[model samples]
Target: MQTETLTLNGQPFYIRRWGDPALPPVLLLHGFPEYGGAWEPLARHLADRFHCIAPDQRGYGRSWAPEGVQNYAMSALVADMAALISHTGAPLTVIGHDWGAGVAYGLAMFRPELVARLIIANGVHPVPFQRALAAGGAQAEASQYINFLRRPDSHKILAANDFEKLLALFSAKMDLSWLSGELRAAYKAEWARDERLNTMIHWYRASPLQVPEPGQALTGLPDFPRDKLLVRCPHLLIWGQDDTALLPEATEGLEHYAPDLTRVTLPGVDHWLLHQTPAEVARRIKDWMP
Candidate 1:
């Protein structure tokens, strides 16, 4: 409901906040091409119960975006989040979607003490996701865009023609009813910020996670260390059955990593479920929150 700035890791980061400061905190992390405002709808829905804090994670919106792929590595990304969590006063619930989900998993895995609960929507867990990608199946096919995003000139392509490609990437095949002209403009503005486009794409380029080449075998790819990546907290995964980017197959076998996992699949919704049905998403998170 309100915007503020906090310096994390010695860099200024922007955040959107809602609800009473005295209430329990719930951190909302947005995915690529979106800023903290992406959580506005859901934040408003739960404002009465929880203090929703959505930060423009390092490389997007008004946040500081340091150059280079290495700067966007999981370690740096997680460190930025760890600093934010410490700044925000942790032991709070974390809600993330897409890339944000990856960060949430890392937080729960590497810094379990900071997270009371982890909730992800259409996000991947390392084990199952890598398996799906390495298996050279539908999930792998759907993830080809990750490779494209890793390209050096991806920003130009995404920014050309007024972010036409970016718009499609965000809303293609899913409902756009919620993405009004004003909302779309706001998103475009965020994407157009200084060094944000490449910085956002750097998140994909800096990762060790690789989407296997189409039809490629899993024989040579480095195996994920399952033991080290396990999330030792109550985890909830919400899936939109129609999400093509991160198929249902990605969620398979997640329980192996998250022993206390709750999975909820929503029919007819796609990757844009949060934007399409914010209230429903909020309700699901609220109902599941302990």
Candidate 2:
């Protein structure tokens, strides 16, 4: 893998690329509190067929972390993605997980021209997500992390004491023994490389900044074209059936947004399916990509 840093929309962003540049490109977006390295295994597997580019989105890992929460809003996140795709100069297949999945949906919703296809793991489309949150039972249960993230001092607490707790959060649901000591150590080292807690938390903080008004579902939200709202490109959705943080119900009604969606639910898997079932995930992706 080759690593480099480039300024996108005035913020310095870090990226890691694998495979031949001549091949078609696929951008992998990592979730909260994790870096691009999380996708290294999958990237290596796909390198022979696809040029895989993984970037530390905005605030996590080696990417730029601007002060204040507003800088991390969805608009800014999508802008960074556009700049990165332009910089890469490749027809892109975008894949995102968790928070990164949210950004991927935004890109498909607002900038369809940039994405050839999308593969989302463990996150619902924004429209269904907003509706689920408003429905108020299972949605609230699955989204408890949002409330935790909204706390003002949450970042300080997570980052305190040399980030012991933050490291724990990264490996919370996974069987650490399944991971090599080197990989585990690398995850801890990345969290320790910079004060990422604040920037990571900003993802949640800035959410309400652009949230729809009360009683307004994401389908009615401005900036997302309703008539042309369906994901124009092909889509593959990989969901972990046992994900506690994002319940399967969160995926309800997704077909309304992705008319050409393909789905696979892995039993006995958690939110960290990428880590727990990397090979399986890679196989599905390889088959899904045209």
> All candidates' lDDT scores?
0.87, 0.80
Q: What lDDT score goes with residue 84 in model 2? A: 94
State model 1's lDDT: 0.87
Best by TM-score: 1
lDDT of 2 at 182: 75
Which pairs of residues collide in model 1? none
Pairs of colliding residues, candidate 2: none
- Tens-place lDDT per residue, model 1, 1-290, is 78888988788999889999899998888888778898888888999899999999988999899888888888788888888889889898999898999899989999998999999988988778887888987888888889989999999999999998887776666666677788989988888889799999999998877688889847676656777988989999888888878888887888888999998888888888887777888889889986
The numbered model that scores best in lDDT is: 1
The stretch of ten residues in a row with the least summed lDDT in candidate 2 is 209-218
Task: Name the runs in model 2 displaced over 4 angstroms.
Answer: 167-180, 209-225
6-119 per-residue lDDT for model 2 (tens digits): 989888899999999899999999887678988987887889999999999988888888888878888899899999998887358999999999888888878888988999
